[model samples]
Target: MQCLYFDQDVTSGTLTIDDPELAGENLFDVSSQRKRYIRNHKYGMVYQNPVKGLRMDFSSISNIAEKQIAAGGRHVGNMQSAGERLLDVVSIPLFRMKEEPRNFSGGMQQRVQIAKALSNDPPILFLDEVTTGLDLSVQAAVIDLIKQIQRDLGISMIVVSHDLAVIRMLADRTLVMLNGRVIESGLTDQILEDPNHAYTQQLVYSLL
Candidate 1:
């Protein structure tokens, strides 16, 4: 699989792009302007902490609209409509759309973050430990929301999580990393059923 390497120590490796817009280009060697273009136009990211992904003091709708504006959206009415639509998609009540994310619960805050991330409708989304700090029930709900969004939007998602159950629920393919290296990778069911690496085997067994 063609994967984007992030925050990894790579002494020598060429990161090639498969997207037709920049096909065969080495991402590792991209110019700063090219990188900015890629970031603003091609990718959406949800951080582990809602604070990192959202402006806490901004209203949920404003937060979402700001992302749309950043992505070159100019129509005020259209941006507001998009923000409301995303909030509904994420199951946040419309009445609370004007409330700041800081006033919401962890799950609600995460939902706002997800809405904002989808504001520009990027093809690829990077979700980093999105459910890490939520309650169990909230985590399940968030996971379900992600699954539904993926089904409805068909957007590619790179979800990073330490929880095997979360992986079981969200991933089609799995990559097990150890000390920054991918130790095992395959179909999620295959890894859960018969992990090849010793550490992977132990991880699977412990969940039983």
Candidate 2:
């Protein structure tokens, strides 16, 4: 994911760049600088914004292959080959292989985000508000794509969405958090039909 921090603080808050736990640890502490901690930390905290989390300079294809290149997937003279292979995997348009990401539409851009996340071959994918601004049709497409990616990749998907429709469609299990605590947790259908916690009830009712 591409994360841009204009006047943003990436530490010590809900961002959880350091720990998978999503809370605790002082940002001022110098120990947070280690690459090992950064790389291996939460695989399920999608940045609050999609555009903030990506590299705008690269094409969708380039972005997808970036992880492989970082891990030395590119041999002496096969960089293009590696890229083309990844493009096929991520479903990027081969015709626009060299276009910058700013040129794509919102849905296309989101697909690039997915491609970039999958590039590292992460076992768990975090999708934070992935469909916030899209219309229903586009939202459905993106949600379906995520499910397809998860199934084909065999990875756990943590989709953080305030939209119940998205949750009901994409989530296998659901967790309801209010005031920063988990108030309810169970299968999506169960939670939708019968929420035990008041916060969950409010949240479910709000969907109506």
Error of 1 at 161 (Å): 0.8
Residues 12-41 of candidate 2: C-alpha lDDT, one tens digit per residue: 433333344434644334243433333433
Per-model C-alpha lDDT, please?
0.87, 0.67
Full-model lDDT, candidate 2: 0.67
Clashing pairs in 2: 1-53, 2-52, 2-53, 2-54, 3-52, 3-53, 4-52
RMSD of candidates 1 onward, in order: 2.4, 5.1
TM-scores for the candidates? 0.93, 0.75
Candidate 1: segments with Cα more than 4 A from true spot: 1-12
Give the lDDT of residue 186 in candidate 1. 95
Model number with the top lDDT:
1
Worst 10 residues of 1 by lDDT: 1-10
Q: Over the stretch 48-123, how does candidate 1's per-residue lDDT look in tens digits?
A: 9898889999999999988888889999999999999999999999999999999999999999999998999989
Q: Best candidate per TM-score, number?
A: 1
